[model samples]
Target: MPKCMIDGKEVEFTAGENLVKVAKRAGVEIPVFCYHPGLSVVAQCRMCYVEVEKMPKLQTACSTMATEGMVVKTNSENVKKGRAGTMEFLLLNHPLDCPICDKAGECDLQDNSYGYGSAYMRGSEERRTYVDVNMGPVIQKNMNRCIHCTRCIRFGDEIAGIHEMVAIKRGNDIDITTIDGKTLQTEYAGNYSDICPTGSLTLKDFRFKKRAWMLKKTTTVCEGCSKGCNMEIQHEGDVIYRCVPLENLDVNRYWMCDEGRFNYQHTQDPTRIIEPKVKAEGGWKTISWEDGILGIKEEIDGQKPTFLVGSDLTQEELTHIKEYIALQHPGATIQHFGTPGLTSTQQDGALDQILRMKSKTSNLNGAEKLGIAPLMNDTIKADTVVVMSAGRAKLPKINAKRVIAVGVYLEGDASQFDMILPGLAFSEKDGTIVNHQGIEQKLKRAVLPRGKCKSLSEVLMLLTNKKARVGANP
Candidate 1:
């Protein structure tokens, strides 16, 4: 461990930890543009300048190592002046287009300039211009807004193992571009949006939708696969604006896959079922929650119950459902259903606090916690089957006299069920979902569950007399 003074406060940090990391640990955030933890340090942006005792000049805090008895001043006038100078230089090439730029609210350059630079520009000459380059299908590049941070280039070459971007030319003509005019084709390509200090790299789907400040962020886990990537879903009211990676060092670091970032549109699609429907004589009709519960109870009381658990349900829901089922029918056979062996190799190496099973669905650990194992490679036969399909179109067919489908979406598979119970979607309810690594992440209600749709716990309470309400602590 190396002890150093950051912003006049003495603190100890792990050996080899950069000054920026040490400063952040000591509650001082050094404004950075080119620094990334997972990628190689280029020290190009020069925004994280700090004054150190006995040093001739200010140093880049990101690349400087914390040493024992080192005295660093981050907020002193000298350091502030150097940062202000750097901000001014960075803005020299940047266009004053915050109003129309997609990265307006969340732009680091805009924020840093307001914090450390002059309100007015000193340059009277026309700003330099460059042609916009098509970086990739997932990323668009406007080199004019770029500060030449090289975070994107470093990320492609180091983290993603793809050298798709590079700095070309020299001096005023220094620009980031691809070789042979090829697009940046990488699986983890969406991260450039986060690394971009300005509006240089913007998401095609989220651009111009809403300002960053206008969107509410909900911390949740990615359900794309078993690699439970910690995610923050940003939305306005019921509409999801975008999905960004929440920094969890043990989980998906500061990166998430492009699929995880863009797959949220399906959650708000019109095809989702928003209300409970019962298969009555008049086809499938929307039923009240009270009537729906009673109908399920009536059916369960007369036959052996089979609970079908989906991998998508959170661990908490899995716990409550499994416990309630055991208290109601101790001998009930619970079957786990999900797209098995459907692992994708686009691993984000981010450790999700949520325990990820070999099966990627969110509820596997919850089922295991309740002393119930997921259905293995064995066929299940039951008189009454409780099928919980989070979004899948079909479930493995087991010999069952009656099928009960509980989910938020309507598909052809639910049609086979005698009773269809609509459940809350990800945005509709408040719950905790564990990621692949067993990190329990909480998701608050972003939108009201449409119609009379209820959560899995609510539906279980109705099916049986067992108390099904879960506490917030879990």
Candidate 2:
């Protein structure tokens, strides 16, 4: 391996590794705006200017490739002056609304300005501003905060494969907007907010919500689909505010679709049933956990119930359910169901060239791996049916009169079920799920179980007249 000198430290380089990457390896910070690791290197920001030993002029570290015996000075006086000048120009038009901006704590522009910018302002003219256009439901556009970093434009072009965002004019008057001021068209539009250095682009779903630093982060995988894209659930006071993509080169890389990004809403939905309920003559009535367990046991006492297990459940939950059934009702018919028309892994393929999969549930592969058969024609023919899901899998058509649903359910779902045993959402429990690619990943608990919701293991134990054990590994 070849080595290069960066800020008086010798760092090994991988042939094509650039200065910014190499400098990072040596614990030296090289500030950048337009250089995202997943996106193309354009050096349009020129904020990473560094003094190369033999170079006549300062070079942008993002575009400069490191060679053997090459020396670079990242903290030189000339480098500091150059970076300060770049910061001055960037902050010239940027608004001083950091206190109200959603990107206040996490904005790269704010951090760079504080670290490398001049204390005094040079421009006396009125700051430039634009009449911000609506970017769509996923993103809020504020063209005034933009520093022409072009990260959002490049992301739409190179990563999302959509050339919707573009720069219309040249230089200082350049406007980064959709073609003809149109709304964003891609399904992965939330990522434009993620890669933007400034608050020029922000998530509409997360706007005016909790500040970035106030939210506690929990690293979890997306249950939106079988892609199992890694992400972080940001919550404060046990209330989830947003979901952002976590970098995992093997899975979703640096991006997640909008469906997955906003998927956390269902868990905290006001209409979601959080208490155990039993159907009476007039309507549904909330019941205690003990009564709910007794009701389930009495409902399936002598009947051979068909278990329609949802592929959205974790591998641990599925295994526990299978074991519980084998011990209690040995001959009960068990089947797995997820996306309609897509039963087996063979039918599960890429929905697009990007992260989405044909299987809408995260654990479709795990359910199949547990030796469970797919439900035929999306129909259950037994006299009694037990439908279990984590709310991601689509509900199947039931031919049975006696229906007991276990897991997250909405108020409208009450008509379809005779009894509902409230269970944890994916965010409220920690367990493993397998993607369509057979890669198993863990879903970390981000919040406590809603209301009287219990794990499937605990519910199953109570059904068998055994003491419920919480957090027991399958």
Off by over 4 Å in 1: 279-283, 341-358, 377-383, 392-394, 397-401, 407-414, 432-435, 438-440, 465-474
How many Å off is the CA of 255 in candidate 2? 0.3
List the RMSD of every prediction in angstroms. Answer: 4.5, 2.1
lDDT of 1 by residue, 1-474 (tens): 669998789899988999999999899999998888877888988899999899999999999999999999999999999999999899988898999999998889889998999987798778889887677678878888988988888888776778888889988888888876788788788898888778999888788888888998887767665566778888887678888888878867888878667767766767566666777886778876666667777777745587777766776777787787667778777766665443221222333232233454554544455555556544567778877756631366667778777654453434667778777666666677655455666656666665556677766766765433322211
- Give lDDT per model, in order: 0.74, 0.89
lDDT (Cα, tens digit) per residue for candidate 2, span 1-474 = 999998889999999999999999999999999999998999988899999998999999999999999999999999999999999888888888899999999999999999999889899878888998888888999988999888888898888899999998887788999999999999999999999999999999999988899999999999999999999999987799999999999999999999999889988888888888988989889987767777788888666798889899999999988997888888999999889999999999999988999999999999999999999787767788898888888887787889898654444456778899888888899999999889999999999887778887678777776553334222
Q: lDDT of candidate 2?
A: 0.89
Query: All candidates' TM-scores?
Result: 0.86, 0.97
The Cα RMSD of model 2 versus the native structure comes to 2.1
